[model samples]
Target: MTAEPILTISGLNVDYGTGANGVRALRDIDLTLHRGEVLGLAGESGSGKSTLAYAVTRLLSPPGVITGGDVHYHRPGGGEPVDILSLTPDELRAFRWQELSIVFQGAMNSLNPVHTVHSQLTDVLTAHRPGMRAAERTARAEELLTLVGISADRLAAYPHQLSGGMRQRVMIAMALALEPEIVIMDEPTTALDVVMQRQILRKLVELRERLSFSVVFITHDISLLIEFSDRIAIMYGGRIVEQAGAAEIYRDPRHPYSDGLLHSFPALHGPRRELTGIPGSPPHLSAMPTGCAFHPRCGKAFEPCAERVPALAPPDAGQDREVACWLHH
Candidate 1:
């Protein structure tokens, strides 16, 4: 039998406010995360990829509230399943980085410009494991750095003194400081150039192999997801349109949006040509249409698409992938 999921989200709805004031950032969302697997969430900007990540980690800012549904986080610590949507501030403090951690995009900002890498790394160790003495913390910091392919000597250098790739590795080291079972990486390599991006990606694969932690990776680049993730979930306008194994998603995209996204990237070689994007932008959350949010830009959208929001249903039992598009369902 399959193991229970480490992170389970069901009917998750995040609204900006009350009644008519409500803006649906996410609606009827569902996801399951298994141990030691990478689940990639891909979408264009404003499609609510980050919103779902934020909601999962209980990190959403003011005005955005979990209006309905549940986020059930099952940790190895043997505590009751945490209802992340209802966490108190004190509870959240105890949970962050210990049970759940995030590697934010532009994570360089997370590192202090003035402090040495040793200091920053030590801070996370000290905070999470308060019983650890300086010597223990130092050893732990060095161990984590080694895991990311960086030497312990670099610990003496400040953030500004490091290259972009090194700084990114340091940030990753800090996130792994707590050795949490799960890490939510929100476009973690967006700011880096291609080479640096690959370097980090390689290290992440290595780190995951060593630590055996699951990852909820969010990004706009479908090609990167194909390279780094085990499975992919395609999000469009606050809803999941398609989800499947990365190979299957690319090999045969059932949804038109997924197809467009797959085609939008530049040709890798020969020409290295400039690419064109999908026709329009994601819908404004404050003012969404009555039917499908993607119908405006979806090529296969027809009469039924304008009148009903299709559920994520599989065409057959043999095919495990689920898609919400009317044409596919």
Candidate 2:
């Protein structure tokens, strides 16, 4: 991956309501997506993975508000970065599909049941490129379907007529229709069988190679992230607990939570080992614990862990890895 950053998020915070009663959904998030690289986000449910995605994309709905943060889109050739949080509604609409697109979770249900695939695909083009002729839109729609390995002949098919995998592929096709610089996929392969999941992920990697677009892939499966992503960020209790290269994290995780997560999944090639999942369930957002959020479940917690939250920083002065834990600090 290149050193140039395509997107930068710093000090991001999100809440579900206003005032002291509000639930803190995300806290002090800092992440960077480099050009032409897949950055994987892995954690258990309610780890703020989806919240981070929605916050960055400016798609968070009612009661959910971005309390503080800056999300900057670094255009090619390094001009002044666009402040994503400052865009007006009109500008945000224009910015979304053209610069960044997202394939939401449960893509199968995301599609319109009444509309045919062709109509849905062409709708994006018609809205974005109003001057384009109908014939051109049709051609582009067909091409997009073909790009995702779906035959053009299925363009007229409704969502119900298509298989689950095909519907997911159609969603991917739509996300890439405008050739955006960044694509955020929030559990795009959810509910699919393992074989189908692998097929879809492989196709995404291939498409990224051909199109040269960066991706932020979010999932609960750490194994899949380790297999496909260039780097992995592990989230827990609304904060980033660890961030490192996928192989580095797999070989040696710095955070106790990350270690537990790695051990939760079975190895396919290495010697057989027991799977001891994380000891406790994730903390409730409304009633979060004091100090470090993971301290309650962390096996290696110490005196300082419960008194103060650990900053996410590199353990060694020159290392690229970052972990939020008193053990490393």
Candidate 3:
């Protein structure tokens, strides 16, 4: 069954620094993540996928500011939606990990080398569920490890002792400790090999099914997104150029940037074809093109594309998908 919308992002804009010299890292972005569904975010390295993830979780560091936007999270039990952007520091602390958790990029490296897996897992529960007794926390830690496919025996091992994939799974287990309604993973598999990456993602989907949490999976790999995501949103130069169902995007992408990204990866089953990557580098945020930031790199660019920026909207009539390009206009 299709789940109800869990999070809504509207007119989201992020900038680095303040003043006329500030660079726009994310354009006005509007997106919706449904409950228990996986939404894949794809783009080049500098396209602001990670920025959006951090922005949503209110985790962005110094010099980064949200110039405009509203991020709303609907309560799980049909309660009134809360404005995430407006939460106070104390409220944010209570909200995170309980309502939503994020597994950051290179998350395996984030584990404390000095602490055992058992200690770390228990720490999260200890902080959030202060009333839980020591024995209960220990049992919960072992259960969490088991949920992520890690044996309870590994609980006493330090981060350095675990393999890279195991470390990633541990991070995932920690994220799920609070049973948050949503989990945002940013390039969680970057350091793992292909086989391990596949295993981790597959296991993640299994856990999602069992736990009923939505996912915002951010990665630059379009092929990976196609295989795992229910819906895919393609971003370029910090703006989303296209968004649609994964199958619809793979079969009939409406934007040139999305098409370019799809073709950049080779298909394991389909007939062989020459692999050609998109030409020209991504636009620098400081000197982004006036109209469309992707126009210079888009092979399908034309007169109107260079003169006026196209808003993300549905193409023609009777289509649910949206694209930001003059080709459809």
lDDT of 3 by residue, 1-329 (tens): 26589999999999999888799999999999998889999999999999999999999997999999999999877888999999999999999999999999999999999999999999999999999999999999999999999999999999999999999999999999999999999999999999999999999989988988999999989899889899999998888889999999999998989988888989899799778889999988999897878888877788888889899999877887999999997
RMSD of each: 2.3, 0.7, 0.9
Count of steric clashes across candidates, in order: 0, 0, 0
lDDT of each: 0.86, 0.95, 0.93
Better of 1 and 2 by TM-score: 2
Better of 1 and 3 by lDDT: 3
Q: For residues 1-329, what per-residue lDDT tens digits would candidate 2 score against the true structure?
A: 79999999999999998998799999999999999999999999999999999999999998999999899999988899999999999999999989999999998789999999999999999999999999999999999999999999999999999999999999999999999999999999988999999999999989999999999999999999999899999999999999999999999999988889889988999789999889989999998888899889988888998889899999989999899988888
Cα lDDT, model 2, residue 50: 98
Model 2: what TM-score?
A: 0.99
Backbone clashes in candidate 2 total 0
**Candidate 1 Cα errors over 4 Å, as ranges:** 1-3, 77-80, 267-276
Query: Which residue runs of candidate 2 sit more than 4 Å off their true CA positions?
Result: none
Could you give me the TM-score of model 1 versus the true structure? Answer: 0.94
Which sequence of candidate numbers ranks them by TM-score, best first? 2, 3, 1
Per-candidate TM vs. native? 0.94, 0.99, 0.98
Candidate ranking under lDDT, highest first, comes to: 2, 3, 1
